[model samples]
Structure formats: structure tokens, C-alpha cells
Target: MSPLNMFSRLKNRKSSATASQHGSLPPIDKPMPSQCVSSPPVLPAATMHVKQSLQPAAVMQPKPATAAAPKPGSTDTVRSVVVHAKKLGSGAYGAVHLGTCYSTDGSVHCVAVKVISAERMRLESLSREASILKRLSRAGHPSAVRFYGWFSPGSKKVSTDATGPELTNLEVSHCLVMDRLSGGELFEYVLARKGLSEREAAPFLRQIAEGLAHAHSLGVAHRDLKLENVLISASPSGDDICKVCDFGLAYRYEVDGSGKVLKGRPLTETCGSKSYAAPEVLEGRGYDGFDADVWSCGICLFAMLAGFFPLDEATGADWRFERVKLATQHRQSATRTIFSFYDRPCQLSSQVVDMIDGMILVQPNRRLKTEDVLQSMWVIDDTIKADYADEYMYDEAPRYRGQAGSFDPNAVSGYGGQQDMAPLYRGAPAGVIAAPPPLMKQLAVLGQ
Candidate 1:
């Protein structure tokens, strides 16, 4: 029997069961054969923690030991973690550093410190992020990043003397100390290889799917499922070690008695990068964060395979930019496109493309779930797991050595480049979790 025939038969059986549950039997025109295709295992219990050593198969070794430990209540704790040299970097609203912490009892550890402005912390978005981090840390979600805690370096003593108000009184600034994923963003790794072949990308994709599977099991939806937000963990084993970072844009759902709609803080503002936005979100219709995340995951897969935005316009100057900007800004107004934006013909195999098509479905009701994505034919191939043995896990770039106790801007490599920090600008208010846009009114993706 063909794949479609098999699927149709399964659908018929499922429909029959639904009719039977309702005390009636809507008959099928033809009897279907039974099959025993295996499904991936369901994620473990909410309280369960994933083992620490799980890494992706594509990676073969641990990252270099430049990562630093958290400082003892210092501003540079997460921002400038210097294990041996100046492995420091910065981002919007904060600075990041590589450092090693030596405990009073002689124990040593490595960590990353992120420094955020108090003013920015007041923004609802950032505040929600802090809350999510704290909650995930509390829940011990394996896919979530490990948040050490929050700190305010200059809150205790009012010492201002660095010539400028911004530079002076450093203690006033708030900082978030988080476990740094030394492997950096997966985008960097994929891009570094000048894009990966399908054989090379499959194992990498599986690792991320496992993380998402774990998150889905815990009822968490990482709404912003983009390349930048997916951080590779600092582990020798690559497949099981991918860390889904930035839960600041995520949402947790609880099903009610009827199990129709999800109850939680509704996100009024549409969040996340525009290109990866799901079709329903773009159309100003109601959506679920979970469903949208799955869609974004499919898009990420497409990008990993094709090296371009799935919804991008082929040959226009800022053609999709305005639509994307509006879609991102006006929570209720997501524009719809007919086909994926690509410069070349689609290159993935039939099964892989079939799965991607399912994920990119415009209607939330028809999209693929995290579990379904994991069960793709490509994932079932033994070669994917086998190939992991040969990949380069930690191919570190050039080093940025700097003197001890002195700050050097040019030495470290930030996300964008040297000096590429998130610009210091006032953002959305803190402590307020914005309601999801009308399109995302229902918790759509949780079940899938």
C-alpha cells in the first residue's frame, strides 16, 4: 500500500472511533488495512528533568573552555565572564561576558552574566522574560535556559563618578545572570558551514525537535522559535544538548474542563521576528502560540535546508518588509502570502517537504504538531544518528585575547560583530505580559 492509502485508512479508523464515541457509526466506503508504524515517544512528565549530558548527534565534541563562571554579585558577572581572556560581549538592553568563578572553598565553575538596564526591566516584554526565566528555572525545563537569578549591582551604594551619568553609578543597573550556552546560536554554526547538506542538517534538526518535544510535554510554547533564539548547548554530544533559549516570548497553557480554549495570560501584542511568523498570525486571525511555534520550526527547517526566509519575496526591494513590519507591530493584522519566498527551487526530499508543507499550513487547524514533525520520514533514517559520529561539534572561531581587569570593546565577538550590542533604547514596559493578538486568542498549538 502507498503512504497516502495508509494515511487515509488511519484517518478513516480515527473518524470511525469518533463516531462510535458519539453513539453512532458513520460508515466508511471501504475497509482499511491495519498497520503498525511507530511513533516517537511522548515527552516525559512535567516534573521530570532531562539528563544533562543529552547533546545533538551532529556535534562531535565539547566547545572550547573559554566560557566563564558567574561572578559573586558583580555587574560583570554575566556580562563579562572571562575564564582566561576577555570573552566578553553585549546585546540590546544588556552586556555579556565570559568568566570563571572560583568559590571560597576552592570549587570552580563557568557561567555567563547578562546586564540589563533597570529602565528596560520596567518594560512589560523584558519583565515577562524575567518572569519566564524564573518560572522555567523553577520548573527545571530542560529545553529552557538555566537562569541563575537577577541582581542589581548599583542599587546598594550610590557611587556615581565615571564622568557620565550613564557610566557613573553602575550599581543602579539590574542584571540577569543566566547559564550561557557556549555553543552560541545554531544559525552561526549552520552559516559557518556555508549552509548544510540534507545529510548534515537532519541530525541537527532532530536535536532541536527533541528539545521542543520536551517543552511541549511540559505545556510550554516557545513562540519565538527562530534560529537566533535556538542556542546550541556547550556539550560534546550535540543531538540531546540543544537549548531552546529566550522563553521571554513563550507562554504556558492550562486546559479547562471543556478542553476547548486555553486559559492563561492572553498575549495582546504579536511577538517574534516577522519572517518566521505563522500564516494565521499574519492574517490577523486568532492563533495559538504552540501552533505558531511549530510553524516557525518548520520555517527554521526550511531555512536550514534552503538558506532563506520561507515567506520572503523573490525579487523586490523591501516588498515584504512593510507587510512584515505591520504584521509584527499591529498584533491583529498579519498579512497572508500564497507561497514560500525562495530564490531557487525547493530541494528537500519528498517526505521532508511533505512535513514542511504540513507545518506551513495557513490554517492553524491543519498544521502539524511537534510530535508529528518529529516523526517525519527523514527523522526515522538510521544514517542521521550514525552520521553524528563524524561532525565537528566545537569549531571555535578566532580568539579575542585581552588584558585582565581592563575593558576592551574591540576584542570580543558580539552577536552581529565587534561592538554589535543591542542599542540602548527605551522598550516596552516591564512586569506586564501583553495579551496575545486576536488571532492568537485561543491556545491553538498546545495539542499538536
Candidate 2:
């Protein structure tokens, strides 16, 4: 399909987990092209289980555009940049849009604009996310998304068009401009095309492991690291590499119980997608963000291989509690169930299931850390070199041809900018429910 058509398809079916909702088929086990060794490979499943399980119940929904678009007045000195905007996806935060920015410099850029209305902004709030993105940017972490800048009220931009009292101006109320991810998301990619075979998924898994390891080293927890947040971007040499995005729920580990830091206080809130959330988080129990993120990654890896969630949520609250309790109580049983569920398992040189076994242990303490997981031996392959297809094609800047950097690296501190954002609550960080002691120990072991 043409890229544009695929883009439209993504928009139309994006709301439903429509990509992989159909019954499963045998896992595709094709070896990745020689050039894209860096890309992850897919694992073959012995038997495919098609029943849908715990898909993201909460898809991001955009807030109703203000009662009316922002009013344009003489004071509104809108730059009127010709930005073609289309909604990409939505979450608790708001709607993410794909936009083409036409600049006076004659440079046309494709950017992702996140639109959050005042109400939604206050509810889900991007403050913490913005802070997390900024922290990652300052650290130059390859795994985290790079922040460009934001276009919100009081910015240079005024309006997009001159129309009926300028009323339906679709006022770009504080849009976040980010590098457009042309490759889309890894989740959708795998769903459209069967996930890479075990051999194929390794390199991609390695990159993710390396990225997670690096992030953990810097004391940051991505909190959310599903296929959706992973992006494929072109390098200067035209090769695609994965870069993690979406830091709305990231937690800075080094920061004290309070949000204050040498740089600035970070925004804190108990937020995360339900399916990928660690057991502790869902139970309203306090857990280390870093450890929880690793657990989520483990769930992702299990789903990737098994084609469904390893553990299912029981129907009622009481049943649900019992399910989690049972799953946590007997880690070995849970792991065995997952192993047996996959009919066509990847032919492994070693005990591959052990790795997943360690990752999703009911006890958070026993779960693996980002670094330890990367070193787990299943994800790494020294010989593999991935040749991912070029997706986001960018024009090369002429060398020694009077070319200048189009965007200022630090011109605008997208999220780091100081604001009088009030603290939602003050105390021992609400919802700081401690993890079960056994779970905490398990997490510590996994981290070690």
C-alpha cells in the first residue's frame, strides 16, 4: 500500500486494536534483510492463539475543542504557518497529530503536534510528561524522544487562516512539535506484518535493551515502553534506528520523595496504561517506576512471542485480586502456563522461556532490571546486523554549502520552561502504596 494510504488506514483503525485483533496465524519467521540487522527479528509460534486479551481498554480520546476555537484579536500576531494537521492517535494526555510545517526559511518539516485543551490539559496534564521529555533531552539519552519545542498560547503563532470572525480558527492551543515518526509504531508494524521471527526480533530487542539499560543508568524510568512508544527514524546515512518516545509518565529515580531537583521540580501523578501497568501500580500500590517499566517490557516481550498477554485479568474486582494474587504466589506455575500456551515456539538454542520467566515474575523484586534483562543472553546477538527499510526519508543538507542548523537545539526549552504549575497534591506523594515485601525483594534481585 502507498505510504499515504497506510497513514489513512492507521487513522481510521487506530482507535480499535484492529491491527492484530483477528485470529492469530503461525508466527512469521523470516530472517531480516542483511542491511537491517539492527532491526529486531520475530519468533515463530508453534500454534497461534487468536483470542484477544487485555488490549488497551483506554484509547486516547481528544478533548472537545474548546466551546469555540480561540478568538483572534489584533493582539493575536499569528504567524499563520501553513501546517497540515491530522490526528495521529490519542491517549489520556490528548490527541497527537501529524502536521507538515511550512516555514519562511523555505524548509518544509513534518512534525507531530500534541493538542491538549485547557480542561484535558488540567486533567491528564502534560506537565509531568513535558518535564520527563526535557530531562531526557538534556541527558542526550538516545532512548527518549528528542524535544524540539512547543507552540502554545503566548507563542509567536497567531492563527492558521483568516475566516469567519476568525472564530473556527482551530487555534493551535499549545501544540507540541516533534520529529515526525514515518515508520509509525513497532506494534502496528508487527501487527500488519507478522512479528519478526525469534532470529529477526533479536537485534531490535538488543537495541531496546541497550536503550533501556542506558535510561536506567541515568536513573530514569520510562514507565511506559510498549511497541507504540518505539519509533523508527532515519540516520544521516539513511538507515533506520529505533528511538523511544512518550515520556508523559516517566519517573526520575534520583529525585527525592519530593519532585524538586537541581534543575527543577518534576510533575508527578499516578498515571499509566492499564494493560502494560505493573501489578503494583494497578492495585494502587506504590512501586518503583524503573522496576515497573521493566515488568511492562517483559509483558511486551511475552506478548510478542506468545501473541497474547501471558496472564489474563479475572472478571470481577475480587476475582481480579485473586488472579493477581495467585499469579504472584506461584511464579513458576505462571511461567509454565505461558510456556505451554505458545504452540509453535521459537526453536531456541537455549532456555529462552527462562528469560521471560524472570521478567514477569509475580514479585516485582524478582523481576529483571533493564540492564540485567539486556544481558539475559536471549536479546543479544553479536553477529546480527539489521537492515531496516528506510521509512522517514529526509533530504541531506549540503556539506560546505552554507547550510545552517534549521532548529535551535536549545533555543526553546520545550518542557523545562518554568511555569507556575501548581502541585496536584502535597504529601508522601499520593498513591505511594508500598509493594509487597516479597515483591520488593524480587524486584531488587531482578535489578541486581
Among these predictions, the greatest TM-score belongs to 2
Q: How accurate is candidate 2 locally (lDDT)?
A: 0.44
Least lDDT summed over 10 consecutive residues: which range in candidate 2? Answer: 436-445
User: Model 1 compared with the native: what TM-score?
Assistant: 0.56
lDDT of 1: 0.46
Off by over 4 Å in 2: 1-82, 101-108, 158-172, 236-239, 253-270, 313-336, 339-351, 382-448
* Each prediction's whole-model lDDT (CA): 0.46, 0.44
Q: Write candidate 2's Cα lDDT for 1-448 as tens digits.
A: 2111222222232232111111222332442223221111111211212122122335322121121222222122223333344567765435676665555455666767676554445422344455545555667766556555555554455334333332232463556656677878766655443334455456556667677776666556776677777777766777556777776555554443453222132222334544456666555444666667777776666554433344332112322223334443433334343232222222322223455555555567666666666654445433322222111001110001111212221321231121101111111122221110000000100110
lDDT of 1 at 208: 72
Model 2 residue 184 distance off true place after TM-score fit, in angstroms: 0.2
